[model samples]
Target chain A: MDIQFEPLQKRRLDQAKWAYTTRRINRDQNFQLLGGTLIPKAGDLVLARVDELGQHQRLELVTSRRASLYEEDEIVVVYGNRYAPDQFEGIVPDHLEPCRLVAAGGVAARLLNRHDRVKTATRITPLGLLADDKGYRINLSSARLPKAEQIDHKPLVLVVAGTSMNSGKTTACANLVKGFVRQGIKVAAAKFTGTGAGADYRALVDAGADPVFDFVDAGYVSTYRVHRDVLLDIVMTLGAEMSSNKPDVIVIEVADGLLQRETARLFAIPEFTDWIDGVVFAANDALGAQAGVSWLSARQLPVFAITGVLTASPLAQREAHDICGLPVYHTNALAQKSVSSYVYSCLKFRSQKQSISNPVREEVG
Target chain B: MTDTPQPGKIHCRTIEGMSQTNYFVYIPSETTDQRRIFYTVHGISRNAEEHIHGFIAQAERYGAIIVAPLFLKENFPHYQQLGSSATLERADMAFDHVLQDVHEWLKIPPSPMHMFGFSGGGQFLHRYAMFNPKRVARMVLAAPGWYTFPDPGQKYPYGIKSTLEWPNLKFSMEKFLQIPTLVLTGDEDDQRDKDLNKTRKIDCFQGLNRIERAERWTAAARALGRAYNIPTDFKMESIPNASHAYESYLAHPPFAQQIFDFLFEAQN
Candidate 1:
């Protein structure tokens, strides 16, 4: 049997639904195709066909919109890992064999585990890897934003972390962004850690945050199992880029919960904590809020306020308030000007108080 | 048989790029090799000439150079508050630039300078010290309408807390408290006139009048200094029979003397 060769064309590549994870790739550079023998790496661009539709029926596109996915529909996605305890646990497959669409943001990986309620992930068959004219595999890492120069005028870094996924971290962050916007303050937001997803990014933009970014923009389809230094570099690089825009404050939301492996390691590193001005812990219940605050406090991290699902309940809010000694605010209330002003002032105060340099006395005649 | 050295001439300078307005500088005839710079900021009255004239005697006695940067109402409407809005240039930054230009023009190296602000100037000088504590050797705030207290509890322009408009604004209590300071107000300067900042917030936190505000600020600052374990020379003097008028109080007995003694004659 003779193997037929199909040369990649601009029209053909454009016809495939481009995933959000490959949004940064220069479409014009993808002029060739490499498949079969090449081992797929995390962030490597892959043109695949939808084999079966299951949990995710739609694909988030490069335009930040969702497009319905059909069986046999050709799609362009990234090879990466996904860590969602509520949904699925998946990792990059070693070969060009079939894989699962672990995330709607367009991640193709081998399924490792899944939550009891989550259906089997949508399956995809690898057609080939997009390549340049030189046959170099086009990877998302190659399209990452360049690291910016160190900014002398640093911004106040406010982190929003939760007890776990669905603990209302994104909602709290969006509300905070909205509040700052309503207050006429220039606020830049970023998701420092998370699987490549446009939901959080779009929410921030819709809430009036300019220059919003996520781990994908930092060249990662998923931050799970990534090296600590690489994660630190993402933060430093993204921070410099955000600071270049000169926002009054940069609100970074670390995905998942405090106990998450990556978040736990990040909080323990002084390089990370010292760079942060304050933290806003999001929890689902009063006990969770209390424990999260204690965990942050033990790391000597300044947790300014308690906000998340717990804020939805007055009783929970009161209970958390009683033990945490921190203001418990409904995530929606964060959109109020007064509340945002209070939060902004608190963060600014903390930044100043924490940055007080040692005194060097000079004699005056 | 004696000739009085030419009474020091007040030189009017308009450093290009400093501001459209001119600032006055007076150089004493009897100059020392390492002469100190004395910057006297005027209040809302924008009386730069009066400040230069009022402090000439002290400048001469101390062999210091006097600089009075005229913060014109048109150019620096919010100089006292150090406003950093779209319309209002950062007065602290503008004034710092002026100080640098003045030092360069005078052929003197940049060093800590003594500052005395009268009324509106008092407001600028104190806040300036808070922002750049290392640049001030000693300071005298004479009858400012209100003060930014050393309290971290209140926000900026009221307390020492930083603001978004000025994110780089950092106030180290331990360091700023090290600078010798004197707060002067008149016994008759308790009027709540239109010039006074009578906002509810100011009146509640500071006092209703200039004298009360001065005393409160002094006490609060001294307390902070003590808490920081730093020797504080923060002092306040109430001039007798003097109103809010700068010219009247400047000549009042012990007024100029007290300023000179604190700024120049005090022992470290």
Candidate 2:
């Protein structure tokens, strides 16, 4: 039930607003990392009482505050669960008593599993729900997402997928964005799927992405476990957002390794490739790069280049170049202006050729 | 008249103690009357020459001598050994012996030196500062991958808790809190590549990514200082418009000025 509510603590008065201001967030309650029709659907906003403090040393109220400052009993409105590879125990089971701040980036969760590195997680106790101004429990599904317009043209979409978190996908995407921008092309970027955090989005902007967006902007705290269809909707919605900017090329980063449940399912779909013109696979080593490129090739996905953590070491780069069949772009070369130029031209030519042969004049001004 | 140096005057010498490492020393050519010595630590790339030279302009500006020693991988191996975290190698002993040599070579009688390290060097300096807080005037750590946090929850590379149980290598939380520390990171330096130390031991205490680890260490240090009722001279700074590159801050005028000012401005 949604109703007029009050915050017991001034610190949390701004926590919900922080999905905009802060890079990492830990909200009140009702956050889910999984992608399903679970608790707190889109548009369903509720009042959650902050119960306890656990693993999270810091908390974001409005402008990103600390959790250590909050008292025992305080009510704060927060978004759903956060699913991060580094520190997640499980998703929230019910609007229950011991809900965890699954992501320090600010998503709440039930928390099923976690790594040894995760000390005691920050736990928040949720009080009974309250009705909103309209008295209708805010459902995320009811949130208004812009419908994709039937467009005639498809922009050259370059998707950056990685073998796992910390595999250099963000940097690769940033490098590509910066490279393309220096080549006098309008570049835009969006992280299609990942836990909620502003790190990558900000990095992309610094790397010359004109306008950048992420799953959080698509109205989800994180896309870690969001259902397949909902995740797809988020992708299309993100495409619409980037397309609105009319970028010459759009680079999207798909979070996590290819073996990740969400990433694998997303990649398995044929429609997913329809949106992507080409893909760059980033891996931690040459072995993974070759395996990823070959895997994508077998699946009919276009992997034009291999890059990532391996590029930092010359030995790794040489090995990747030799084994991966596809062109291996080293870190320095990947960050140069020519790589983006080459990528842009290749994508442009492919799309133009597709439009010409298909008889359907797809969108591209 | 300022004690400015003639352009490109670096004195190279070998550490007889280690018998393998080469170091570069830059003293203001005009006068060797140095108020303090500022040592620059190199990262994993082992490019000590550039790292040592990066502080040249400021070294002259503040009349401080600069020393950058090269640690060959053949001797130091991975970050574990070079950063002085591993027990069997005792990088601490090497550094102690090496600093003695440096002081003997400089002929200034060993003095408290300002310690500056970038990337992997940051890892080494923090650990060095943790155990040898007495020898350092101020510790400037710029973007270390992992931190030996001031906590007993984890051991060594993860926290200051000693794993080797060396009798002399023990760290006092009180003494560590007193060491003035300045942590620098570009707001854009959020690189979490595989090269970043991600061992379970480190990942547990230091958080996942570099930014997380940096902020966490700062927060933890402040918190520890508060618990012990000690003063925490720790600050985590973020430079804008820069990523995870040495040149972004080391050579950039604005950042170099900020870093140099932190070390020299407060000097009497």
Candidate 3:
């Protein structure tokens, strides 16, 4: 059970601290040393060695100068997994043999698989050090990795947002959902951003959204700082959750303006575009309607309809149709059955496309 | 001395008057309440509740009592009849109803009032003021349709141009200036208000460099007052960042406060 430790490599170090200042390197599952403390204060080189014990690991460093004093919590090495130091040497699993190591600068280090032994090294760059700290010790096996399960027969729908906040987006979305429900379409709705009050979700529920969830339900008070990747992950996770309900349609509403940074980032991401099917632009007046259509069209997002508060006026409705050149419905008008029929025809076209592309598989054999 | 009635108390009374409109009486809070009585005309939307809310929010600090009558679309038929087109007829009916309700509530004669209009409401306020100038203490004409005095030998009723029909019966400044009026329009309002080049079209002697439609309307009112030998208390003010919807004016505290100061400070 002797655990083998590898010196940090330059490539691994560069990858470890991508866009971050500090990095952490751990030994034997426990004790950790920061690169900022162990490396040279100003361009000095350092060589660090890993020693294996029966059940613990240790690091011995040789530097051109005495190690610099560093405060705790300062990022030392960007990429190193933690391990228990008590059983350090013995814990290096028996799977990763012939490891090779690399490092960039003194910031990070890594170990890679060599022919028969672990080789460790480092490379320096302004971006930081790459570390192959964990040399290829044949101890860890991929056979223990978990497999991803296949999901069967899930329905998906896209939710579009307006370019401004409180532009009747949620109301239009709810009414559209209601229109679908009246024709026996079971629907689920979800909100993308963890911002603003839950007025839209409440309206959706009233409009017959069988299952509704907002970003708040996803355990976020706000998505202000949530990265695009994390946001897409949350959306996909919610989509998976909605799939369990077996909805005929899923309507998602984006909070905030479409040009908002978070929204732009989300829309720009390829995965998000793939998941989102149709786009709806909600606006307050004719000008906003026109602007929204132009902005979304530039981004190549599919716009299915334009709806909002201004729909209360016949002139605005007509102007919106003329300007945006899209099927337009006012919230009040959509409440009527004739308008609801038109909305259903649009949804039916979408539903037919979905059925054709992805025939709902009952189960994975 | 024992029989002298208190000025602020409103006495309840019923009447079998001949009128097709329902009027709500708003009694002033006190005898010292010199704030002008505000008569609000409902828009074609016919949401009296919303109009009342807007007026209350705008006029609360002024201690103004606002009387509004709800006239259904069916009763008014078109926007013109309910708005500025039939000025004298609508005014007579609206004022009579307001006066009767107020008299019943205050148990006194009809007092001088202020008039306010919103979209279509502005249309009614403009014509009502013309039909009965002596009744209005001050007026706020917001986003009204185009108006003009009748030409000689033209035989146009009330001196308005015959060919000038407002889109959706929403009038403009030419009509608003005949009386001392404050015009309020949003800064980012659509092309209609902006294209009028309101500053040059209306006489804005009092407001130089204030090139807003609302300011132009006020300037025209001021010029009309000066030319007609009426006291030149006319003023024009703009809601810095508003549009034709009047939302900005409603939201800005200083705008509301200034309006109160202009309307009531003159009265005291």
Candidate 4:
């Protein structure tokens, strides 16, 4: 079938809201449009029309801004599963049919489940898949930043994780970035796992982190349900890219809590644990902090400090301090040069010890 | 020594942001479009002007810019070895602040710095290079009172250990050893004095005198480089007719010439 290739019809692509996940896609190569009988894979570009608006009334655009959605508005989004306990649980549909905009970051998935508080996800009809000149469908994988075989110089990497969603991981990460920046240290940041979104990316940028990155740049719209090996590859690939930038240090935030499937999978992997210099646990309360610290310690992972929303309350801070020997610093404190200096020193010490334990083989004369 | 004509003008100015400390800049009279930057650090005496006078001829000869920063005793008492104590502002940060001012004042592009340090300044330069190896292009250490050995088992100011006072302390031996280094000392500079750090641990781990300390530190650095499979360009030279004092070496013109030759060897 000769799909319409008219200039006026192509204007539809121009008018559509390009989601953040598809930001790396090159539109110039999208010469053909194919639809029907084609099964959509995760990360495949999907052109769809808004059937109705509900939980998501706006779409995050490529420019790191949001655009309001209207009925009959066309959107170019990536198909991927989303895992947000506080919001919606979704999965990419096998067939090209009507699906919901599970995330404002431009993800289309069949709604598997959602919390009782939210209205139904906004509805969208899958119009077709964006295709290359030879009729091959475009994928985020093809547009990902160049993969790195191995990193020669790995910068100091600090991972910020939490007990659960809304535990202030991004805020903690951003404040840490600010602290490193204030100390005149060159810092780069990345979100190792998350649904494709610009809010977290923008937060790091505003906090003065140069060359911030995310899993989207690694070709995934969302990390939920991604295979353990694939997730490891994403972290390594993104890590090499971050190291290539040669920042003095790197702050990486892993979405959700330690118990979260993908996050747990990564923490269990020796490659991920060895690659990171340290882990700062963010928690909702004293008990959560205790549990997270113990879980990480059980794996012999280096837990430097406790942070997150719990730090807002002095009582909770003291409680966490009493329960866990580690110092509990508020995000505000984490932004201070003194605190960052101390944290950097601790991470450096830990990285040194880790390197010694896993000594690199020396060549004999 | 013949009276050599000075070929550079010295500019004494306060660092823009850090007004508490001042620095000296020596710009060659005959400027070149591709002029390189050379930073010379002074010992406890803080004789920054003498440093300018000492290196002015070499700066002109190589058409390189010279920066000498004065670390006041009251402000940076522990300027050497960057900040030995927790309360003091790190001398490395002050050094960086001066470089920042130079970048703005001279309108020069970003580039790694070639460094020369004497006694206390030598202590500062080597530690600074270890913490931020990528920032240094080349280095020359002249008769430091002591040295920070490449042993990670010991603490900072003694070995390659991290501390809370210094914010940017990511020391990588593999990277630090890549920088070409020159260690210089006087043949008669073996006398132990008040200026020299005299501790049982220092005496045992390093050496009793500056000359021995230079030899031990140079050897340790080379050993570390070899351990990491990195070829280190480290050289140690002794002044035949000189002692511990900067003036004593400055009087020997060839001493100053050796440092400049090492710093600009790559260019040649």
Candidate 5:
């Protein structure tokens, strides 16, 4: 039987770019559109179909251009269940089902867990894998990783990480890029991980970097349930791609909170440790700053300075400084060229670029 | 997309005379009263499967059929050689024969095709449309690395005249000028890539990069229209912040809604 389908409108998933090329939509005897809570994972892309949309709730549907949003009925693409903490969470079971919209930015996964403040998830159905001309599934993991020589010549890297979403990660990172540019240093900025979004990358570019890039450039829309190795590949790809310009410094932002699934796993890798020269940690307040600093300290990771939402409050800044015993710079202070000087001071004084062998072993051991 | 799936099939169509077996078409489940068609060309990647997606939405909405033909380097090598006389297979004739095969395959009469191409496709369309203006309704020459300028002093591809003195790349000015065209490229697409042709002759005639090339063709074409008595329908646009990629083009601005408006002026 010949089946005709329209792609989900405003598909936020960059993978949706291949929706039209997907030739196969076959299913098994057990293939019933199940109303489910299983979030999509790697294996889920194999051969899923659109599950029935029975429940009524808000659903976030992003378009192919990353321009706007749409309703649940508007999107038509194959997606898997997600099990990430910060976004949606659930198992991508053997059966097909209707998963909730765990992320508004651009991911559809089942919700198994969420923080209390987070709202109800939007619902969606998975269409299935978009196969290539040869009739093979388009594997996100199979995408190319940039060669080591592509990213080899970076001057130095200053990573800005946050304690939680909306903890002023973008604010801090953009200002950091501005500060470095004001100091007359050529800066290339990047956001290696995250579900794909245009604003953050655009914001970073607008802040004065010659150009900016994110995970979307490498293919996967959102990094939510993306494989760990793919995340490493993204880091390498962005590193090599951004290094093409030969900037004097490269400032990268690791999306979501420090403890978020992908970022946490990425930080655990030794290549990540050896990749960056300094860290500028961001947090909401003193407690978050202390927690973030403690987390870094426990891993023997070097912290350059603490900045973020807590910097907006004088008392929170003072408390964070006292508690973490680290230099605290407000978002405004970071915007000033003085922040560039401070980072330079840290890189100059410390034995930067520490060579770590088997960062996974060091973390586990 | 929970509603009933549209009654259309997006399938591949084989053209026996074509360079590759990879051309595809999206015919809506049903046809409207009037038949309209689009012939889209792919970039250097030669992936018609990927380029076809850009038009599937418009195809369904306008009841228009999109035929995306993949022109391989093996059959059509070099951005300029395909249309110039220095080729084993003349791209202009390839397109003509391919469409004849398509019309036969679809069992439909010939219709004025709306031609569109991106990057290398843009190069093919501009020169092809210039020679086959009667076959084309309107054209979009987008971000071609360089163009075939209206000049006899310079070389072919870069300019119409060549030292080889092969078949003339010339056409009637009034006929070509009347063909509605939009010559466009990204504003930030000025980088010198390895593939960018930088021979001293090309650099001397056309300016520097893609950005300069777009400006050169727009100005030259419009000027040619003015020199003759014909009214030029040619216009130029630059998508800000985009550089040699469609994703960045979408990000810099919402060029989609604008594109739909341009392509469907005849439909609407």
Candidate 6:
């Protein structure tokens, strides 16, 4: 199969005055452009001066290669104001100034025009540009978002909840995300219940949430005492964000106890239930966690795993498996490579089964 | 300054990257250098630091390292009922992270680790012990709220409550019976009395007196141990003239001495 790289109309720049400069390509510092140039072809490398070294000295570089003809160790060019014939090492530092370009190789070369510039725009939020001149704007959000008319290939989502406030739900969700991510599967993570805190989202990201969102991003101070309708809206918004990522799996974390008015209401919502593929119950110990699983089972929710605070011990793991009949995992157990790998295998198997069972079909004629 | 035994100062470190502000105190042991570590969970108030100070004074007498991790109200929004994921996650992470910290500080294998929860703290400790039974050498649960059996339909002196309705009830009794447990409560504890008063308060569905709950827990543990044939040593006791609060019990020489003796007793 031929690979093609389209100029992603996005650019990122870093400004540093004098001292040492770091050269980077595609956000990686390992690759550097050595100073040299013959002809700039469709996919040919070009170095443009991006920053001032001292007075007359300018730093320049071509960091990316066109989709075609780009080899791992292919050499590019770095142009500086003061060029040394024998020494190109004086310019590229540990950090590089940001620049933008369109590369064409093979099929990409045919699609490129010599004067074609990647159409880049400053991301303007309602609050205006985040930075004026110095900070480079990088579009972190993916552009290949799933469309309403397009068939949904995204993995089914599963959100878990506890009975009260400290029942291990977030840990379970994070562990599940980590497990899925380790399987080379992309996963989106979000907290569907409770007031938003940045820590859980960051933890989820660290655990391999390709994209993570929470109630805080939705402009709520906290989910405590919020109306059922408002909570559902926030959850739906998160689901939409996850869907946009087109992840192989989505893990939603519900805060507080399952019996809480907010949690119960969120779980009972038809829209939320339909999106969920399975539920995982996290509790402090084996007993309460089992009770939580039973409650969900009674409501006919397909619970895939029963994990909680106790997973740190093998006994708890065995007991959970024996009693709940669901695979058990401990959040702290992720620190162990063997346990993490095992969890990944289980989740991967489930994800593959889900895909096979529900094949994505194109729009009917 | 005089070398007069300085009441150990309470130290609090705010965990970075958590939504609610949670704190844990390091109580240096006053006795032996063997370095015994215990984590105390606070009751309804979720004030772990206070409990740490209280336990530190007691711990100092025994020369055991005491760590009181305060599960703050802010951290656990639902003060009365703490089954929420936020609360569970916070507790799990706090304990998980704190264990690492404790291991680093003690500079040894994480052994002789135990958890003590009084009242609301007892609820948390029981759950913590239940979840991580292997790591814990002993669990001292003083007036815990809930106890479960294999069958949810069984009735007890406290009341006939169904364990099925309680959250996190998925743990097996066979596993629960394996851990060595010490259940204690005050004879005159109003909570136990209240629990006895409310007949429908089974499975933590309603509140009960601390004494009645303790007795029921003892019976349940004994019954569970017998059923599982787990040879578990579950002890239940009521300190005379002491209410639900450990302050009174701790103040009385007989009660205090008994507790200290029980806690320090060798576990083979």
RMSD of each: 13.3, 22.5, 22.8, 17.4, 30.1, 24.2
State the lDDT of candidate 1 residue by residue for B1-268, as single tens digits: 1222243788776655645656888878786434467788999999899888887877777787788999878777888888755235677777767777776676675558788999999999999898888988899989999988775545677875555764534566667888999898988999998889899998865778998888778877765453333578898988898899886797686787688787876532
Query: What lDDT tens digits, residue by residue, belong to model 6 across residues A274-308?
Result: 45566667777777767888888788665656567
DockQ in order? 0.02, 0.01, 0.02, 0.01, 0.00, 0.02
Q: Per-residue lDDT of A17-37 in model 2, one digit per residue for the tens?
A: 332322323344333312222
Candidate 4 local lDDT, A99-125, one digit each (tens): 999998999999999989998999999
2 against 5, candidate with superior TM-score: 2
lDDT of 5 by residue, B24-92 (tens): 676766773235677778788776777567666666777777778776677667533464354555766
DockQ of 6: 0.02
**Which lDDT values do the candidates have, in the order given?**
0.81, 0.66, 0.48, 0.82, 0.62, 0.50
**Candidate 4 vs candidate 6: which has greater TM-score?**
4
Q: What is the descending lDDT order? A: 4, 1, 2, 5, 6, 3
lDDT of 4 by residue, B1-268 (tens): 1223233667787754443778888878996435478889999889988998888777888888888999989878888967756446678888878878778777775458889999999999998898788999999999998988765445577865456653344466667889999999988899997888899988866778998788768876765453343578988998887788888888787977899889888888
Off by over 4 Å in 4: A1-8, A361-365, B1-268
For candidate 5, give the lDDT of residue B75.
69
Q: What TM-score would you give candidate 1 relative to the actual structure? A: 0.58
In model 2, the runs with Cα more than 4 Å from the true position are A1-55, A59-82, A128-131, A139-144, A149-152, A353-365, B1-268
TM-score of each model, paired residue for residue: 0.58, 0.50, 0.34, 0.58, 0.45, 0.37
Q: DockQ of candidate 1?
A: 0.02
lDDT of 1 at A250: 86
Which candidate gets the maximum lDDT versus the true structure? 4
